[model samples]
Target: MSLKPNIVLVAALALSVAGCGKKEVDTLPPAPGPAPIQSQNQGSQTRIVPGSQADFSNRMAGLDTIYFDTDQFDIDDEDAVALRRQAEWLRQYPAKRARIEGYTDERGTREYNLALGERRATAARNYLVSLGIAENRLTVISYGKERPAVLDSTEAAWARNRRAVTLTID
Candidate 1:
């Protein structure tokens, strides 16, 4: 055998072995989504809208929002039905968290309605806490009349505006 050919073969083998030592690195993971929609009640579930996966999953599970009658912060029997579902879901997922957004009709003064909204949100949060949901997992915000569900002045519109919406967050 020619010594030159042996040398060439050895060089090729060395090059091929060197290439095998290099690893194929994976791409970086995806960035997280934006923060959840929180009501004005700053001090705040997992039913989500464009939040974490758990939050989104819970929202898809039907823990969206609960409504109340006009000028009422109290959770009525009908609303209680919805909250009970929310409580059960929260219990099922202890890692999940939520925000209670209180809203009101345009009938009241802006200041008054704001206070009412806070009260409504707090009522919902407190109810959730009473149901064994961790109080630390919940936050409350009052949008008051500023963010009405319905803008018209009719009774039906006002009734729709009087609500506390629960949103899932990270």
Candidate 2:
């Protein structure tokens, strides 16, 4: 048996074995029936349609927004108080993980803004860690000036844009 013939035989055998194992994947079950839409009167609080509201409320409840002064990453006394409240919330829910997303206004260069945002997130994470939260349970990401909380260029909007947001994950 020459090497070339042997290689061809092996390849054929492998392909045959693979073909034997081929299976028809079941197509996804028919899409669920359309949900019944409910109508709400003008004066009433709109009731969320059941399953849709779960994710909305969960995301809403876990989101925490903290603002920062221009060109600053240090947690000032006022920010410290707010972070303490965030720490307390974490202490209340030991099993949850939180992500600190840092953002900045559009005043600086892209590279500088990214570094600033990262420092801002790290500053917040450090404070949480100092408050006895496990560093592993906290993650940080810097969006820089890319994802502004407010799009306007006014002072008020710029103030809103300089922020770190904490989002809880279970």
- Tell me the TM-score of each prediction against the true structure: 0.64, 0.63
Worst 10 residues of 2 by lDDT: 50-59
Candidate 1 C-alpha lDDT tens digits along 24-88: 66887779766554323335432333345444445546445667676678888777777888787
The deviation in Å at residue 86 for candidate 2 is 1.0
Pairs with steric clashes in candidate 2: none
- TM-score result, candidate 1: 0.64
- Tens digits of lDDT, candidate 2, 1-170: 57999999999999998878767778878786544344233563444432232332343453366788999998888778777877877776687788898999999999999999999999999999999999999999999999987889899999999888877665
In model 2, the Cα lDDT at residue 1 comes to 50
lDDT of 1: 0.78
How many Å off is the CA of 92 in candidate 2? 1.3
